[model samples]
Target chain A: MKLSCTIRKQQYQFSSVREVLGKASEEKSGDQMSQLSASSALERMAAKVVLSEMKLEDIYENPVIPYEKDEVTRIIYDDLNLTVYRDIQNWTVGELREYILSHTTGRPELSRISRGLTSEMISAVAKLMSSIDLVLASQKMRHQAYCNTVIGEPGRLAFRCQPNHPIDDPEGILASIKEGLSYGCGDAVIGINPNNDSVESVTRLLRMTHEFMQRWEIPTQNCVLAHITTQVQALRNGAPISLMFQSLAGSQRANEAFGVNKEILDEAMALMLRCGTASGPNVMYFETGQGSEVSLDSHEGVDMQTLESRTYGYCRHWKPFMVNNVSGFIGPETLYDGRQMIRADLEDLFMGKLHGLPMGIAPTYTNHMHADQNDQEIAGMLTALGGANFYMGVPGGDDVMLSYQDTSYHDDASLRELLGFRPLREFEKWLEKMGIMENGRLTERAGDLSIFD
Target chain B: MKQIDLDHLVQRVVEELSKKSQEAIPFPEEKELGVKNPHNREVLEQAMRRTPARIGIGRAGTRMKTTSYLQFRIDQAAAHDAVMKQIEPAWLAELGLPELYTRAKDMQEYLMNLDSGRFLSEESVRWLEQNGDKHKDVQIIISDGLSTSACEACIPDLLPSLLQGLALKNVSVAKPLFIHRGRVWVQDHVASIVRCKVVISLIGERPGLATAESLSAYMIYQPNESTVESDRTVISNIHRGGTPPIEAGAYLADLLADILRVQASGVAYAQLRVK
Candidate 1:
């Protein structure tokens, strides 16, 4: 594909990073070259960052945007032309390949983003592509992995209806489940985080969600994100265990919040494997993020990115169903803002996928956090483009109980429209039968329903 | 002959150390956590299971790790937002609430005059007196205190479940009401005028990042103008992210029943056990 800019007179095309490098080296380093070597025509232009020699500052405070509201942050957001999300989405395969390879590249005018477009971050994109001979080989491997697992397909995502029922009301629990599924969720796991961490509470939600699943004939697993002990109790009480779920962090303190350690996590995995009540391909689901260790005050001396990788190291021990990192959920203090969040989102997926986990993305944001729906959509687009195994599908990008906007049902629809991704095989069939989806496209009927009715 | 390349390695290390020395570098959240005492993890985790506080998180050199530091910041931000955040009146309809005000007219006035928010505006008092009975057995109110999301998130599940439980018990329950920009003390003002045996206000709590949707139920039996915070008993952290709103609602019903049976609440209610 050929990429051209409106303002610049230059037009050039090359298929490989080597070709771009050859062209780049021929020209003087400081010259304003509009078109380099590869693909497509763009109405807008984006400026890119010129990566300096490997400086120590780049590691910790390279793209230094603070969490506190300030002038720089205002400029970062207010700069309308710096459309990282839009620019990246429009970039060609050749552009992405060269962009990942070149450290000294600047963005097109509109591409002057704060974080994800950085050479430092795009290094992850490089790691993601195993080699030029077999492009998206990792994605194929990921698809194969999912096929082997219970989920059975990449991009066939799942979401838990974590309705904070202050009291474990079965009706309320069912409402959340129905609400999630009506919005085209429940492709992966239909789960609830029991508000009260009691065994009884766990069992009640299990029965409620299970009843909904059967009534609807939705092919899904039921999970409750309670403590492992509560899950164990639920198991002993003969409660069904489709996806044994927990929120895990690499640190002892972070995992301790969920009442888990490496040893305990292993034990729980063993216990889950033995739990007779099963439904899905894999038996476990885990949620993690960039700042979990920070939330628990556990990051020792390692950077957030490295610390996150270590957490993934812990998660891989399970080799279970899915591992999701709400890349931007930690707010801006550590991640700073949307730019940082985007970068972290890319890095986390790269690392998670590299570590041999069936990766999922939950693009989340809080009101006071560094991101919002716009930011989440950008991150979601990137993940969708990056070939994430799956992601959380929520209603209107809103998690009422969690008080954050995660990846929305609409986002899933949009991504599938853009990238041609679809949900699990069985759920897809169920959707077709429900007439919400036909062939591969979501019907107008899909968007019109209300669970309240 | 092989080149050692000690100079290159030393140069890189020196550069890293120099940058590190310029600014504080935090350790990873889980670095060397249980090296000295392996049991320390179990100890720390055991304590952590009980509360969401910074107890045993190891430090990075002389400073806190980036995780702990950010955690502190997020918590601080959450608390700050809880105090200063504004809730709009338009969404009250979603919760099946008709917005009512105290003496304080707006958020600024409410923040400035805590006592004013406790007392209903004259118009509101007149409306209440005109439409409602004075000697009610129990009055339930929902308020947006510190965290609006708390009430908005929890009350949907909490109120319905609670009302259902109370109804099943054949308990005398008044029409549910709301307090926009209301405080815990406001229950006393409504209770005194209504002459209720018990008043329960499911209000928002001081939120942390991890528990922004947490709600608190403050119950008082026969609360009057003289009622203080100590006179009210609270069942708190009621949200989907904490205690399930339905569970909190159900539990609140049991607690409110006890208060009604004993004709006492809070500290006194604890002393006078209800049948």
Candidate 2:
């Protein structure tokens, strides 16, 4: 019997740990005999006692929202002025922050409190405020403006008009951008795709978008640099598919079926470096998702390990131009929710809070089911906690359908849940316990407050 | 990132099914002939022939009719659900809808706040006009309700001119149409009923984050009788980042003559002879 079992084990191996756990669970629970089927009443009593002794507490604990959680949420809510934003007609940041913090009444632990307005949170708020203030101030200021238009007068020309970026007359595109900052437009954003277009067209469009912005005096937003990878099919017309999705499978095909042609990626990088040297803000947004076709097999290739290493390679290569801003760490929907924890663990291994280029998560729109919510929320929470500076999508890219309102509500809800709600009734408690006035200053006992406190 | 050749698989399965049919129909010649080099053109052509051309007329109650945005959303969701519910085993031969509908719904809910600045501007104009006795009706001119930011930033600066523009024309309107739906024709439709000297409709163009929420105005003079696309004038892309809303408004105020002269909308006024 032992010899036979060993031969059987050698013949087949379980695919994963979950499969083993599932088999073990089925074997342990498969006994059909009921407690009443015991030969004697005493045996049944023993069985009942064994079952009663099996504690369910092993799987769950009573939920508690600690004080620190409340405090942190209060701070963010107030700082963002989210409540006043929802109800009132325009509110100051300081005012909203004060209202929420003073009202919060709980003492959740610091860690328990959703890690409190992380650096990412702070930067997000700052960026939003900066944009808002700039817009408001510009409304009052004398500013020039431009629009992008396809024009045909003497010849076909693309005209862009913006505050500083104006391209009324263009002798040469590259030279116009080289003139720099004379035009009123703030900044120009140039985009380049290596795999999609050949070097010439890519260079032309990149140069044009940049030159137009330069003519308009727009400063410069980051240029999104891209590369195309193709895998050869041995059969038929020798067709090739883009490598953007091919990176999802790195291991099995690494030696044989798959190859990463650095020729394109390198050329794109070189052009970006040139652009970055001339201007700055060269960035790369990577695509990490399933390829265009559906397949039955689950294979790991171009895994997180390889991606992180390659990204770092690009970062090192472009250090002179500072071309960094890598976008994807976790691929989208290649795994089920049951498998996300493992995926996130892999992400941590590869994309841990490295400063040169921030990682952005491409969380799929399908993972918003209630069953999947916890996993999705955890993935987002981890990405934020892992020191990712900005998430490319808070909401919006839904199978590319462009359901605008749905994206907005999703952003609002995520903010509330991941961020937390401030206490609306804690103001009196704050005054009584802390003796702070409406302005958050000690009124009666202003002096001799404990430094430690 | 595993790339599976699904199109080939689909063709193979479909061809096998055709072989089993009672009529013994031959698979399209293009599909069968292309063993060495299966070009996409032939495949596409064969697929097109397999499916009959559908002519959808946009009449009310027909599939092509344009429903209100809300109605469109509900109907779309219902259709999606129905398809999922009745899915058959044979249909499993082909891949189905991408499993991201819920995520799309959730994310959509997150980023969009449609009513914030937009509905308010329209509603405010409606309320004031309803209460005021100065005119028999009101013209609630709003820009960029199509995109949230257009209204959020533009309406504050644009409102005064819009009001003044109406007053200068001696066009006292009742509570006017602050319809969220926008296109050149929408302005013509509203102008037909408002009966103002000219109906100035400020609507939002399509938006991107960088250029999104830019405002544009469409004006139609003596509008009625199924006015063509050439019945209005437009000043567009007005935002703090692009064209300051106030300046855009001021420019619109300056264009009253051009509007009256053209008696047209959009590119027609700029392009065609409008003497």
* Candidate 1: docking tier: incorrect
Native-to-model Cα distance after best TM-score fit, residue A176 in candidate 1, in Å:
3.5
In model 2, the runs with Cα more than 4 Å from the true position are A1-259, A275-285, A289-333, A338-357, A366-382, A393-395, A399-453, B1-275
Q: How would you encode candidate 2's per-residue C-alpha lDDT over B1-275 as one tens digit per residue?
A: 32466877888999988877857534231111111222233432333233111111011211112332233234234322321122232332232211111111222221122112212234434543354233233344443233544565576677666556646765455443434323344443344334445567676544432244456676656656544333445455566645577766666665654555556544345433322
Model 2 error, position B266 (Å): 42
lDDT of 2 by residue, A84-144 (tens): 2234222232232222233241223211211222212211111122222322321121111
lDDT of 1 by residue, A1-453 (tens): 222222356533333232222222211111111122113322111111111112222322332223142222222223223444454644433355455345454323212432223322333233233322122322433532331125535555444434334344565555444434544666767766554555676787887777777777777677888767568667777887777777776454455544465566667767766773563346777888876655344443223554465566556566668788886664444454666676667767765654556777777766544454567778777776666767775444445444455665555666676776666787778878887677667664553223224
TM-scores, chain A, per candidate: 0.67, 0.33
Chain B TM-score by candidate, in order shown: 0.77, 0.43
